[model samples]
Target: MNKKLIIGMILGAILGIFCILGARLRLPDHASFSYLLSFWYNRVILGVIIGLLPSLKSLKLSLLRGLLVGVFVSFAFYSATGFLDLMGFFAGFVYGVIIEFVLFKLNQMEKL
Candidate 1:
């Protein structure tokens, strides 16, 4: 298995778990079992996408790449939910940066 892939998946799962918890708190009345499950799946897919992206020479470029990907990937869910969750859409951008930053650091550490 690819190291980046594994790292991305783990990070994705962790972030997804957090998102689930947060959603539960925020929409306790509206959240259904299937909705939360799919939401978490979306984050996992983001991680997989992040893991598969080729490494960039510039750190800024790498992070930016992630950010873009995040927004793109997150848009699917946002629109699916009828654009009701603006925060979730924006959070995708943050998650993208965080995932990229972590991947960058891990790769850097590997070289040490």
Candidate 2:
């Protein structure tokens, strides 16, 4: 198993949990899905994306993969609740781009 992927997943989940907790602290009476936003959106999905960073060897690949996942997830959400999940799409897109950049830069630094 890929250690980096495992660690990334663990860290992402933890981060998402913290985000949910913080939001709850601020708004105890938050909406239903609001609580799961961080976990489902940022942690699980984002973790899976980041964990696949190795095979997503290029920025283009990352963007393509991300866009596909984003659109699919958004579609699922929309179909389930008849609500267009703009935030989910946007967040997934941004996560894909950002992770690509981070990984690219890390590779560059390693080569230097």
TM-score: which candidate is best?
Answer: 1
Which residue pairs collide, candidate 1? none
Model 2 has an lDDT value of 0.53
Candidates in order have lDDT scores of 0.85, 0.53
Query: 1-63, model 1: which lDDT tens digit per residue?
Result: 689988898888899888889888888876799878877888898998999887666789989
Clashes of each: 0, 0
Clashes of 2: 0
- Report how far off residue 76 is in candidate 2 (Å): 3.0
Backbone steric clashes in candidate 1, count:
0
RMSD of each predicted structure: 1.5, 4.7
Q: Evaluated with lDDT, which candidate comes out highest?
A: 1
TM-score for each model: 0.94, 0.52
